[model samples]
Target chain A: MVPSPVMLKPALDAIGKAIDQRFDKLLAVPDDSRARLYEAMRHAVIGGGKRMRPLLVVAACDLFHVERDRALRVALAIECIHCYSLIHDDLPCMDDDDMRRGKPTVHKAFDEATAVLAGDCLHDIAFEILADPATHEDPFARLELVTELAVQSGPAGMAGGQMMDLVAGDVTYDLAGITRLQQLKTGALIQWCLEAGAIMGRASEGQRKALRAYARDLGLAFQIADDLLDVEGTSAKTGKAVQKDAAAGKATFVSLLGLERARAQANALIDQAIGHLSGHGPEADLLRAIARFAVERDN
Target chain B: MVPSPVMLKPALDAIGKAIDQRFDKLLAVPDDSRARLYEAMRHAVIGGGKRMRPLLVVAACDLFHVERDRALRVALAIECIHCYSLIHDDLPCMDDDDMRRGKPTVHKAFDEATAVLAGDCLHDIAFEILADPATHEDPFARLELVTELAVQSGPAGMAGGQMMDLVAGDVTYDLAGITRLQQLKTGALIQWCLEAGAIMGRASEGQRKALRAYARDLGLAFQIADDLLDVEGTSAKTGKAVQKDAAAGKATFVSLLGLERARAQANALIDQAIGHLSGHGPEADLLRAIARFAVERDN
Candidate 1:
């Protein structure tokens, strides 16, 4: 794993702060008539978790010294996608989880119908942010972000991966299949964030390739870390249910590879992820710290 | 109501045929892994209603002699939004309708999970089409479509309207409130179809305003007609559950105003809708005919 700098914590916290402020401004709906919908949206998005995706976006963009405003916009747009998936995934018709982040799920706080609409509405708003000229003056960059997000979030990407998860009971998957599933479900969005930052920064082809490599390895390592947390962490810490995969008899990294091997695999992936970013200078230290954070965090 | 032109029937049929074929080609997902999601999408979109939205797009684009391919792409994008809304609306958590278009709803035919994701994936693909350079050479046109779609489809628009319908049990609405609900729920999309065409064709401000006026009046008339149909039409003909609004004790145009008055009001709206197009000549004859068809249709 890459050495973590003392400043990495502050860097991550800064990105988190920027994301929260921007989201508050964007999600503020003054229209009392639609105030309820906005309330649901604010509940789901405003107060959230690690915000690792935004951190990756900011760190990657930092590598190219991209404009902060545009980078933050992209970060906010992608964060909406992440929040929406969580909302939908927690719906009664889907995961049926009542608790998320130690609070009542959107559907639990509101209603199923409102939850669904809130998720769908968030998904729409995400694209709107990417398409705006404020996100990027270059139309190609805006279009790139829009098209890539769509593909990454569509049936060909996140939704497709979700279908596999829902039907996981009917089918059996080995390690390789489970790996592919994890890659599609979470890997795609994580990959898009880094690529989106590259698009915003107008990074070189070689730089783009390196960031993607870093993202891919980091994504898998992150998922493995999640599996580890589910197995070992408490609900109070993660702010979500623990050991759900084991309870459901679902195949996850720890289940397939054994807990010890899963831990080793995650560490190796983090090392590789850090290695890919070696071409960059100290500006990428946050990214390196994030790679270690992916596997080392308690929650 | 504008008199139905002798050519209007053939013109609408032509547009319907075009939409059907294009949808077939576009929705063909070769990846067998995600075939179920694609199946749900096809079931919801193809072999459907009058395809009125696509007709509006084609008619408006025709006024500016826009290229057929680009116009078709825009038409398809808007239709995806319409179909997605219908699919989500039919979910068990939403309207809970088992039947749609004379067949099982997406949730009924496939499952609720597939239905939800299919609607989501379709929504994503709509933006994907708009973002592509093939939609328009000018990125501003694409960006405008994206931004407009987000606002019209978000808390201020369709989703907001759906929320109103969901919480209808909690409150009562007067005629004006119900009108606002219906306009936000359905009117916005209809208006966007017209506005989107104007953008694609680079219509003059006056032309855009004229098309919008025509759309606004026509949209209300269309909804009033829908209310009337729900009261009077048979389920078999509409390929849907009729009189559901009345059964649910929901206030609609027919319930707010008596049937005869509602019918008269629809006619008046249609006449005013047609009046908006008076500035145009024979080229807008199809639009004039559609305005008449909005109120006079059986289903």
Candidate 2:
């Protein structure tokens, strides 16, 4: 889709390395009770992912010619929030899904109780990692990271969007309502990723605003592609059951706008995401590639 | 009981005003989708309990002659964490209780999904409130508040203790096990209250340590009294179903040691709490009154 596999693979590799290293250090809180919590946190966090958020961090830094190591902890911290949300969202009391990443969901793999605690602990540890001076050099930057992470993950964003998903069945859904839901549910953390990287790299306000615009557009495109995949792809390709979105009566973009129009929206968003990176030079090539990848991926 | 109504009521009143004012300001985030979550959080946080944590803040601030207003935001923050834990603990997937404070648990009052979100939102908001510069004048004080709040509420502290409680169930728990459980579950927040207050007041390390000792002892005494009340008090006084601990087969202080031995432990803890406050003056008097009140309060 983007003809930029060369750029994507290396950023993905760096994201993997950064996630593993920072995860090990953050899990070392010195109390047995807390240690147990961290063990569960480790299980959920490192379990598996496309590592998209961390990749955003590394790619954004690389785009700015900033060192990847400088953004490592922030990368892992954002992923921790992502992993934690997945764990909680998959609980029997929530989405009630049994499969995630082709494996049993956290509540099924670990005990539901442990899954709950693991998610809670990871959420806190993310902020703790961001706030720690050893990881984040600038106090103001640290504050901004913490503030952004909290806002994105908290009521006004991811969690609130989830509540809406729970209450608003697909039966009465519209395109605007579905987009609004996806914006908070899926877009907040994606925006956090780009913003966090830019902040850590000390990007100018305009550059940061551009990065955010790129992320927001890319995030919506990514979610629409996911909904399409759930509808059109097989279980083997996506690692999740195909067509379960419709079965669950979810308020997805495809469900609201039909497959054709939904696909069109994703392509438009991808174009916008790439458009925002026009003046940033070759460093932003990977980000542009990612925006294309978001809408074009098979799974 | 040390027989001092003179100090207790005033601390409670001040704490009420602090929590109400701070909570009002904190929940004003500009997102309508989150408005429902904010409403649920407001429902859980406001008009609740004796404001134990906030009282600790006021008492500790008074010890150093720091203005109670300085610790107001921190007081509200810690209370938010306390409220969140309670809301989650009452979820049907967790403790499954239907009643708290003479009314329905969050899950019962709202939906289970809303309760889960209410807890998640409150947890994030706690740190959000604490990190705001409006909470404290000194930047270092703000950092200290964040650290203390995270330590007390995160894995090593309240959440871990909660996990322990979940796993322990009714398994012939011993005195040491019960004490450790209470220390983590309840004592952690109380400890934060004292430590955060002293730190905000810029008290020396020694002063912070002493206040911590007082809180630790007070918390245990409070828990034991709560156990005794569950066994003897009516639902009207306790604001919960009578004999819930025994019915749930919970391993409480009263159940482990019998009423008489539990009373002895409560008295010992009260004495220790007072001893820890010995060097501090009128402020210590307020703490001593709290110690006496904890072991003897009807509600």
Candidate 3:
């Protein structure tokens, strides 16, 4: 049932192409006074990364037999939301981050005002893209995707998780607290990626539930690996500061449980993620590869 | 046609009560760890403002003989969006104001980070409320409301207009540019209020267009009067810093057209808004009253 990595690559490439086109279109803001806001948004989003979030979305859609083009805009919208979070997280008042993807953060590149507005606009645009009637097939399904996206990204979700991280600080929070933080902060959006794909493709209830399980596990594994990477990575390689979590006295899975246990937790999640896709055929195989890819990733 | 203000008061109060109840239900974060975020959001939204936006929503629904309860959650959601915008606009990075509704701004009441996340949470909650299946007559109509709300509040809408204002500082901009800014910044949401109400009430195409025209003109007129108020009203009475717009070198209707001409423009738009309600029965009377109220209000 393994979707050949070869097949996934072309699909992934197609998604990249679609996302890039939308990014370009968004950047083409009218040359009016508001152009600066669009410019900041473009700078934030167009600065490419692994594009993993969008890939998950498209892959999820693929699982349910959703047309690639049908899921394209939603995929791009997910990436936009992710990029906006990154931009805002890097803001001086937030994480005080200066570098993102080996380049200056939006606030550093533009002014803080533009960066704030850019983040706002990016989040707004994510919903706008999903809600675009010209792109969606079933408007109800599109609304479902948007609802999922908002729940994942907003308060009681990612933003809430961020607040937890900020408050937890150097406090020796419990494992439950750490998991809650990771789930809300990271798992939510990842869950949406899978859910959006399933919804777009009109997957059966069972498939949708299975994909949710897969995404939840995949997200946790991904975050743990991220924590591990921070401890074991180089700034030159990761394009972000290393050991900064400890320096900032921030709570992380690695800091809370040490490298060995964190690795075990992540591997366990990956196993669970793969296990959820047992009956899904080739889609399951591709998802398994993704699960492996997420935790085994060095950066 | 003018709605009896006395009769409208009870309806407006009902809208307010529904909004409070809906928001209270939605913002009940089960996780205690996010206590601060919940607290900040409560402070930002609960017991805030005249609920003018929600009133417009309820009034629009009333005109179509739809129960105000039908649009109650949406009314709350729209007001949340409006409140979030105000919070962000008052931030030092944006308008740098210290007070709103005679109280400290969100950034002042809570930390800027908390304020930012609170606004973020509220914005997301708006869409969440709209997408709730329990709130709508049918999925398609509900999704339509979602799309309308998204576009009206998004980058091409309110946020875009705010971006324009940020970039408009110190620029001797013309009337058209200023009008476009106001339309997007404020008018979009106003238009959405009417359109969403009509859709929820299952109004005919003609009725929808008529209400849309009424709302748009009222929105423009409201903005123009606001500019004039900023120029001539007392800071204590307006609950806003008088002459702040002029001090910031921001482009405004009054600044572009001069005080006398700005007043004239507002009156003209109010008249036009009234015209849109022509041929409608007593149900349309409230719409006219709101239009007149927009330009003639003291504060």
Docking class of 2: medium
TM-scores of the candidates are 0.97, 0.93, 0.94
- Scored by lDDT, the top model is 1
lDDT of each: 0.88, 0.79, 0.81
CA error at residue A118 for candidate 1, angstroms: 0.4
DockQ of 3: 0.64
Q: How would the candidate models be sorted by TM-score, starting from the highest? A: 1, 3, 2
Per residue, candidate 1 scores C-alpha lDDT tens digits across B254-281 of 9899999999999999888888898888
Q: Pairs clashing in candidate 1?
A: none
Q: How many residue-pair clashes does candidate 3 contain?
A: 0
Report how far off residue A252 is in candidate 2 (Å).
Answer: 2.3
- Candidate 2 residue pairs in backbone clash: none
Model 1 residue A272 lDDT? 96
Best by DockQ: 1
TM-score of chain A of each: 0.97, 0.92, 0.93
Of candidates 3 and 2, the better by TM-score: 3
TM-score result, candidate 3: 0.94
lDDT tens string, model 1, A134-238? 999898899899999999998888988888787787778788878888888999999998999899999999999999999999999999999999999999999
Tens-digit lDDT track for model 2 on A1-299?
Answer: 44464567777776777687678776764554445566677777764677888888878876666655667777888888899898888887787878777877777766777778778877777777778886556777777777788888888789878876876752355777777778889999999989987888888989999999998899999999999998888877776668876887767888877899999999999888888987787777788878877877776
